[model samples]
Target: MTFDRPHDLLKRSPANPLIVPEQVRPSRPDWRVDCAFNAGVVQVGDETIMLVRVAESVAASAPGELRVPLLAEDGAGWRCTVESLRRDDPAYDFADPRMVVLRADPAQVYLTSMSHLRLARSTNGTDFTIDDAPFLFPSTRYERFGCEDARITAIEGRFYINYTAVSDLGIATGLAVTDDFRRVERLGLIFSPDNRDVCLFPRRIGGEYWCLHRPAPRHLGTPEIWIARSPDLLHWGRHERLAGAVPGGWEASKIGGGAPMLETDRGWLQIYHGVDAQQRYSLGALLLDLDDPRIVRARLGRPLARPAEPYEVTGFFDNVLFTCGATIRDDALYVYYGAADRVMALGTVALPELWAAMGV
Candidate 1:
C-alpha cells in the first residue's frame, strides 16, 4: 500500500499518453517506454478497434544487471520484442528482475521480455489511426511470454479473442478467431495456469458458451467469480461461482470481469473490478441471471468508479482503476480506464445515470 510518483496523472494526455512508448531498446537506454494495462475493444468498419499491450524497456550491460523490454505494435507503427534468451538458465532467477527466483544462465539471460497483441484504429473515438501490421504474435508454446489482457468477445459474427498467454509455464488462456480483423485463427491454450479474468457472454445461454473467470486462489482463499460452459468457444465446462468478496462492502478486496456484459432490462449488466484492504482500485456492479448467468442477481454496495481522478491517483501502479475495455454509444458509458498503470483514461457515466448509481 505504498505509492508515489511524479503523478498528476503522469502524461495527462492532451495527446502523448493516450498510449505512448513507441519502441525503445538498448538503443542507448533512458528515454522510457513501458506498456500493457488491460486492453481490447472493437466496433469494426466504422472504426474503433484496439488491442494494445505494449511494454518496452532495456538497460543492463552488467553492473547490478537489469534490462526490461516488451513490444507488439500494429497501427502503421511497428515494434516487436523477444529475440530469445530461451529461459537463460545460468540456474534460473527472475520474478521480475530480483523480487527473487535465482538461477540465470540460458546464454547470458537476454530474453528482455515479450508480449504481442496490437492493432489500433479509430474514427473519432478519440483520434487514432494506426496499423502497419501485427494483429497477434508470440506464436504458441503457450505463447513464449507475450500477450496480455484482451477479451474482445463479438460472437455470432466471430471475434472471440481471449488473450493473456505469458510463459515459462504460468498465466495461460489463449484462443483466437476472426472474421476479418485481417484473418487470425489460432486456438491453443484454452485456460491453463491459475486462470485469468476471462469474459465472453455477449450472448448465449441455455445453448452454452458463457464465460467470466478469475481463478487465482493462491493463498487458498479470496479472488473469486467463476462460471463456465462452452460447447465450442474452446471446450470449457459447467463450473459455477458467479461472485464473491464483499465482506465489509466496496468489494472487500477482489473481483474481476469488466466491460462486455451490459444489456440491462434488469439483468446481465456487469462492470466489475473492486479492491480494498489497501489495494485501492475501484468500480463495481452486478446483476446476472438473464438466463442463469450463474445467477447472482444484485450487487453494488458502492464504487461505480473510485480512485478519484488526477488520472486515478498516480502511476505505474498507484490507486489504479484498471478496465479492460468499454463502449456504450448513445446514452453515454464510454469508460476506457487504465490510469495509474501509467496512463490512458476516458471517463463518462450517464448510462441511465450509471445504472442508477449502481444501486439496482
Candidate 2:
C-alpha cells in the first residue's frame, strides 16, 4: 500500500529550476512570457534539447479589455488575431483567470494567453540555452488557440512529434515529422477532439505503430488512458482502454501518458502522470507487454515522483510536476519536467533504483 516517497526514488537536481520565464526572452517584442514549462526533451549528439511550451501575454492594453489570441482565417494567409472582450460585459464570465467563457454559451471558452513551443539546448542536463524565437507556432485552424505538451519519438532515424493542439473544437493530438529539428513538417491532426496526452511508440509493434492517448468524455465516462494502432501513422484505429484512475489513490481523478514508452528488457517502461482529487499532479510507472502493448503487465500503486520541493509546490499552478519526455543515458534516467507549470526542472534516477522502487 505505502510506497517509497518520490524523493527516495528520484533525486532532484540541486540547481532546481533549470529554466524559467526570465531566463528566456519572449518570441516577439510586444509579448511577455508568463511561463515556460512542459518541455519535451531529446538528446542530440552531446546536447540535450527541449521543446518547451512558452505562455505569453500581450503588453498593456485598454482598461477592462480581456485580450485573447486565436488563429485567423482571412484567406490571405495564416495569422494570429487578438480578440478583446470587456470585463464588465454581462454576456461573458471571466471568473477563471486562466480562461474566459461565455455565460450564454458554456461550450465556448477561450484561453487568456497564447502558447508556442520554443527550443532550449543544454550541454549538461541542468543549465540550458534557450532560443530567442519560437521553434513551433500555431499555424493551422486546429491549433488556433495554442500548441502544447509535445512528445517526441525517434522512429527510423527520423523524429516524429505529437503535441496537444487546442482550439474552439477542443483539445486534439497533432503530428509533425522532422529529419532535423531545423525544419519541421506539420502532418495535421491525427486524433480528433477531446483527445490529448498522446505519445507514439518509438517503433512498430506487431506490424502496427502504437500510440498512447487520453480521451476525456464530458457527460458519460471519466478521462482514461487508451491505446490505438496505425499502419501508416496517419489514420489510427483499434482503440482499447489502457489504464484509468485508481479510486483511492493519488491518481483518483484522471490519468494520462507522459513520456514516450521506454523499451527495457522486462517490458515497455511507461512513465505517466496522474491527478488526484485535489488536482495535484504526480508521476507513476506502468509496465506493458512488449509484444502487445495493449496489455498492462504491472502498474505502480503509488507515484514514482510528486510535488515535494518548494519549487515544485508553488508557481503558475500549485503542486504540479508534469513531464512530456525524458532521456536515458548510461544507467541514469534524466527526467525534465515542468515545475508548478511555471518553470523547468531536472530530476535524476538510477535505472536500477527506479526499477527497484517500482518493484519491477
Strongest candidate by lDDT: 2
RMSD (Cα, Å) for all candidates, in order, is 19.9, 2.5
The TM-score, computed over Cα atoms with residue i paired to residue i, of candidate 1 is 0.31
Using Cα atoms with residue i matched to residue i, what is each candidate's TM-score against the true structure? 0.31, 0.95
Q: 1-360 in candidate 2: lDDT tens per residue?
A: 122346446688999899989987987787789899999988888988899999987766799887887788879666887888999998888887678998764568889878899988888878898999898999888898899999888887998888999988889999998888899999988999999989788899989999999999989987889999999889999999999889867899999999887888778888888998888889888989999998888887678788987778878788888989888899788888898889998888888887776677
Candidate 2 least-lDDT 10 residues:
1-10
The worst-scoring run of ten residues by lDDT in candidate 1 lies at: 4-13
Q: Any idea what lDDT model 2 has?
A: 0.86
Top model number, TM-score: 2
- Quote the positional error of residue 318 for candidate 1 in Å: 12
- Which pairs clash in the backbone of model 2? none
